[model samples]
Every structure is written in structure tokens, then in C-alpha cells.
Target: EYRLTNPPKPPATVEVMDGENRKHTLQVQVLGAEETWHTPSLLLASVGSSGGKVVFSQIRTLDPTEDVKQYGSTLNRNKICDIAFYQKVHLEVDPGQYESEETKFQALQKSDKARLEILQDLLSSHLGLSVAEKQGPLPAYTPGYFLGRHELKLDFLSALQPRLKADNILKLNLLSLQFCGKGVEPSKPTASLMPVFLHACPQRFSTVEYFENLHSEHIGRLLIFSEVMTSSMEGLDGAVLHHGLAVVACQQISGAGRSGNAWLSPEGCGMFSLQLHIRSDSYLGHHVPFLQHVVSLAVVLAICSQAGHEDVDLHLKWPNDIYVGDCIKVGGLVVKTIVDNTMTVCNIGVGMNLDNNVPTTCINALLRELKLAPLSLEKFLALVFTKLEKLLVTLEKGSSGVDQVRQLYYKYWLHSNCEVTVIGPQGSKQEVTILGIDDFGFLQVLAKDGCAFSVHPDGNSFDMLRGLIAPKVK
Candidate 1:
């Protein structure tokens, strides 16, 4: 099953090689000590490696999660998920020709180091790499670097302008375009980041540079205003109607959180507001919350691609939040719609903490994942846009399309079946275990007594952290 929110578990024993031909077993305090349902499932495959070859077997690094042990003894302890396909094969190892099942089980310790390398590679390839070439070297941020750069804002295009026309792996041109081959070779480690482009952020219009890097189908235009006086959404929607979207600011300011609270959007935060057009009778209209799902998932994947899959503890907090670990929030989504006659413009606002832009408390920064390479703003945006475009195509397929989108959503859901507080139909708070999400984006939750229920976001505020609250409260 896809247990993206389950933390790494410690193996029962680890095999180590000593100076002389010696082996030792060591116990590592991984994270979650829970069984099946509380964590991800590892599928065992037999590889013919002998017992002596393994080192570092016990503790598995994070594919993702909040240590299950922290919220100890919740409603369903070690609850193995019954949902089909929800559990994915995260790790696979051969039992090493053991005669007994118990011995075979113990044999898992034999392949720790080898398995970790495999896992890290998979994580890096799946999450970190970018599409085209890496943009020019990110320069150090000067104090007023973005204070007044009106010339960088892109011209709004009325329709997509296809840059390339092929369907194959692209080889980026590192010297010129940012999305080219293997991305910019990893930069030497740095202790400080420029003020405007932290996270090794790319300069303003890397999107255009991507076309120069490799060729592909047309895409929506992105007007990248280096810095703006107000929210990008305001800039886009406030103007008479347009055909494309705008990134709030290469660095945003004065942004508002979902609760109407002021969002701390200092320089270096990947704060952008997008204006996407939704059909009058579009699937997005019926599945409004799915937009959040799509946007959050897009951001999550982009982060994984840049931050190294397990680098930062990232989570797709149900509904609309992107969290790191359990308590720290790293990214988010906020959407607003404007009706222009028959056309509907969906305004999306997003924020992610990059490098020093992170909040002191209640937040975690991707930059903290010391071992992983940091992403340039251009690379981060390219990764997200690429994935999002593919997803939107799939989502446009109707019911079947909707199912695909939802399945991907479920695979990365923060706490797919965990306990959360939700308001009952009568408007009082009640705890419910999110069974999963249904067709229309409503959450299927299970109450303590085993009664089944569904929670909608229209009249309710549904969150994995807190079940469901009044709509106004969210």
C-alpha cells in the first residue's frame, strides 16, 4: 500500500563487517514500532546474496512519514490497511537461503546497506531530477535584489505556445537552458543563500529557457513578475481577464492563509499565485477540492525531485496542506474562482519554505535536509508544471480520469486511515478515522464505534489533523 505518511521502522537486527572476518548485530531506534497497518509494507524478493555481504540492515531511512510512535495507542494500533493498492511495495529483499521462516525473517538484516543504496537511488530518480537543463548559476542575493524589477514580468499569452514537438527523453543544454541533461551538476555545499533566490532558486523566467533547452508540446503561459506590490492572484484577477497565470512573486509578500490569517511570506519563499481556466461544466468544478489535491501533489513531487525524496519529511496533509514531519508545515494551496460570463478562472496561491524563508516554529525547511542537493527556482517550477500538465490531461478524461487522479491522491495521502477530529452532522466535534476519499472528494471516515461516515468540505472543514470543522472555521 502507499503509506507515504508512515515513518521508517527499525529492523530487528543489523549485520556488520569487522576488521577481521567478523559479524555483529546492532539495534537501531528507527522510528515507528508499529505493525502492518501503521506503516508501509515491504515486499520480500529473494536475491542470492550470502549472509556475510550485508552491513546497515536494521533501520530503514524515510520514504516518508510522521513517526507513528509519537501518537501512540491511537484508535487502530498497528492497523494493517485492507484497502487494495493503497499499500505499495516500498522495499524488497531476498531472505538469503534461510531454512526457517524465523531465520528468513532475521535474514532481512543481511542486506541493509545494499538495500539503502537501492532505495536512495529510487528516491532520487523518482523525486529529485529535473526535465531539461539547469538554469544559469544562481547569484548571491543583494538586499534590494527584487525590490523593483518590473522588466522581468513576462508578456501574457492568450494561448499555449508549444516549444518542442517530440515524445522522448530530453537532453538539456546546461550552458544555456536550465532543464537540460541531468540538471546543473550538484553545486558544492553552501552555508548561506542569496536573499531573493534561496534554495539555489533560478532567475525569474526559467520557463522560457526550458523551451530553449528541450522541445515538447505547448503549455500555459506563466507571467513571472520578479516582485510584486500585492498578491499575484490580485494582480492576475484584478486586471480585466487574461489567458494565462502569474507567479505571485518570484518572492511574495503580504499573502493570506486559508484562515484569512497573514501568511509569513518573506523573500525566498516560493510564493506564487496561478490563474487557471476551468470549463463551465468542468470536472474541476464538481471536484473543487481536487484542485487542491492536484496542486499539493504537484508541489510535493516537485519538492521530492529537488529535495531528494527522503531528504525532507514531506507530507500531503489531507485537503490542502503540505507538511514536513508532523508539526512543521512546508507548503500549501489556496484557490479562488472568478466567473467571467461563461468562463471560470480558478486562482491558485501556493507557498513553500525555501532555505531561510522558513518559519522559526511550526514549520520545517527543505534546506535542512543537509545531504540532498538544493533546487533552483527554475528547476522547481519546471518539475511542478511538467507533472501538473500531465495530471491535468489525465483529469480531463472524465470519470475514469477522475479515478486515476484520486488514486494518485490516495497513494500520497498524509494519514490515509489515521484518526482525526471531524464535526458530525449535528455540528459537534467527533473523532473519525479517514477510511479514504470518495468520488466527489468527500472523506470516508470511520468513527470509534466502527460506524462509517462521510465528511464533505462544503459545509465542513475536513483535515487529517482535525477531523471536520464548520466551513467558516477553515
Candidate 2:
């Protein structure tokens, strides 16, 4: 029932309101006479209202296809995706929306008007707005900004330091002090803050600033460095018991990717790893495989929160790639979970192109194309953590939670009813239409002859641009 073949077409009618508060109903119709699975169609209408005649002009808005009517039907799917990308970039400006430079400026001003306010509201509900202040600042260890040692309590640091040192934790200091309520207004709240250790330095964004903006307990410790080896998940095998700990790097010398491909992680990329403790007996633990899906959705929603979703053309490609428009990849997610007795220790790693453009593209570059302001790595991380916290709660709600996430995943993903060339077990190629995810989170595809099969993300390489899904070379 959750699988999708041919999704129902767009609605038949749309209601439009005139300046005088009068409502007019217009019939919606696809532009092209002939429609295919990947056909590009524009829904436009011309109707009269009391104020004036409302004629919906034809514009180059993107649809999920090659526009077979305009271009001949023999184009490949990847070519279609590339064409759609270029068309969307050079879309005709709607006179009503951007008549003049002043009007366009006004529209940009009104965009994301309540984003910060919304973030503050979530912070108040999740982390308390106010709490008792810590007794005093701890001794300054490595001097720069607000000294990292100044935040540590003597008794707690003495104990945690030995354990951290024995574990070979490098370039990180241990702290057991409560989170200082620095950003928000002062108030009296009964709840006291929990104390934990985090990595802070002048090398990147202030560690103190990170916790001040973050409002979730899921990210307990933060470790950020100028560079790291292999991946963020490297040298973290023994840290599973330290739940909610995260490691970040400004640049990765050798970043890992799905199926052992190398991820180009130069400077300006947002790369990090988070360790979480989930109970095996719990609802979320039973669906460990779905963690990748959850993280992927969280990444998309976090960026979408910055500017309105309509302004940005970001979307999820089949398994875990974060694609912009239909061609360029902007970010990705990787999940590694270990079941130790009754505890399922999960490590979620994420790499996003926040401001970097060296590889393919980044989130800010995409925003730039839309004439929007760039997002800071700090703000992006805060939003991502907030979203991940909210989604994890939803995932804990049982079957209904699964259905909600599934619906959202389908909505934000790029491959619905798309036909791709799949290489089977014996290396024979066959074209198949993408249905949806099966119950186990694998991609379910339907063949032309009514034969259905599931494609595992690990075993297959999804080349969306080429419209090819081939077996990964072991």
C-alpha cells in the first residue's frame, strides 16, 4: 500500500483570490497534450475575476522530466535531468512576483521572516529558557576565547580526564560543567542543567557558542578540529558508550563514502560524526536500518528551514545523496550501528557542502543561485540537531511514525515512478520502474513483466544522472 507507481495527477481546479477579496476558480490542465512517465508538464489557467482578467502565463517551471513534447522522445533520463536543471536556473521571471527591482527586494525581505523566531521557540520548549547559573568559571586550560578549562568543574574533570586520556582522545579536553545559559534572557526555572564534556578551540567556531545555540541533549560533547584523517568516524570505535558525542573537522584528508568511494572533503565543508545510545528492546532499535533514512530526511529539512522549501531546489536521491535541482550533489549521510547486549550504539556521520564549491556544489552555493543569503555552519548544525531530535521522537511513536516518515521521504525524494536501467545478479541489464521502499527500507522496483524486486543500497550503485543502477564492484 505504501509503494507508488503512477501517482495521481494534479488536482483539476485551483481557487484564486483577487485584490478585492473575491474568489475565482480556474481549471488546471497539463500543457503538453501527450504525457509520459517522465514528461514535463506545466499547469496553467486563464480565468476572469471582478478586479481584472487573470491569465496564468506560461513560465519555465521545472517538472520531474524531459518534456518529451518540446524535445524529441529519444532523450536519455540523465540528459533530461541536466536539461531540467538548466531550465530551472534560467526560468522566466513572473511579472506579478518580480515586476521591479524594488518589488523583488521586498519579496526577499519577507522571505524567512520567522526562521530565527521559530528556532528560539523550539529552544524554549525543548531546552529550558532559564536555569540556575553555575557557581563559577573553571580554570582556563588552553587560552583563546572563553577558556575551555574555565567551564570545567575540578572534581568532575579530575575523574573524566583519566578516562579520556586512556582512550587516546586527541586534541580534546574533558569538562563536566553544566551548560551555561548565555544566549537567552535571564529567568528563574527549577530545572538544573546536566554537565558533560565537549571539545572547544579557537581553530573553528567557538565551542561555547555551539552549546549556547544548541537546545538538545542528543549532542552531549562537541569535538571540532582543523583537519582529520580518513573520516569523522575514525578512532571512535571505543567511544560508543559515550552517547551523544560528536566529532567535526574543517577538512578531511581521506573522507569515506558509501560502498568505499572517496568523498572529496576540502575546507569549508561541514563534516561530523555523532554517537547515540539506543535501547535494543525499544521501537527505534528494531528498525536500525531506517536510521540512514531518518538522517537523510533531517539534513534536507534543516536546509529547507533556512529559506522556504520552494526557493531552494534541494532533494534526496534514492539512497543517501543530497542533490540540488536534479544533478548536483550537496550533501550526504552515513549510519553505523552496533548492538551491544541490550544497548544499540548508533554512530551517525554527515558531510555537507555548506560553503565549499570545489567538489560538485554546496548548500550555500545553491542558495546563492536563488539570490538568498548564505547560512552559517553553526546555524545549520543547530537546525540539524533540532530536527533530528524532533524526528527521533516521531520515530519512537510506532507504526504511525513509520508511515509519517515514509510519506515525508517520498515527498522530498527525486525518484518516484522513474525508470532506470538495473544490472541484475547475472549482469544482464533490464529497465525497471521505481516503486517505493519496502518494509525493510530497501528500494522496491517493478519490472515491465510484473516481476517485483528489492534493491539494496549497499549492493547497488545508483547513478541517477546516467539513469543506471549497477552492482557495486566488491
Best by lDDT: 2
Compared with the true structure, what per-residue lDDT tens digits does model 1 show for residues 1-474?
Answer: 235344434355556664233666554332222254454233221223432222222334323223344444452433422221223433555454353677655766676555555566443543343233323433332211111122322222112113311321111221111111123242221112112221233355454554342221322343434443344444444433333444445544346767576776666676776667766676775565667778888777666644345555677766677777665677777877766555667778877775444343222234543555556555565566667767777888888988887777766666666777764555566777778777656668888898997776556664434333444543
Estimate, for each residue in 1-474, the C-alpha lDDT of model 2 and write its tens digit: 111234345557779774335688876654432223333333445453422222232334344343655555565555445433112211233333554578675664564334334334333533335322332322222211222234443432454455543222222212212222234322221112112223334565755566665777555333433243345666344444355656565655557777566787867898877787888887777767777887888888887866454668789887888888788888888777778779888878789989998657788887878788877776777777777777888878888987898888897899999999898768787889999987667889999999999998878888886788888868
Using all chains and alpha carbons, the TM-scores for the candidates as numbered come to 0.52, 0.58
Which residues of candidate 1, in runs, are more than 4 Å off? 1-220, 305-311, 340-342, 360-370, 424-429, 448-452, 458-474
Query: Model 2 scores what on Cα lDDT?
Result: 0.62
RMSD of 1: 21.7
Error of 2 at 198 (Å): 6.8
Q: Number of clashing residue pairs in every model?
A: 32, 1
Best by TM-score: 2
The C-alpha local distance difference test score for the whole of candidate 1 amounts to 0.51
- 10 residues in a row with least lDDT, candidate 2: 187-196
Q: Where's the lowest-lDDT run of ten residues in candidate 1?
A: 168-177
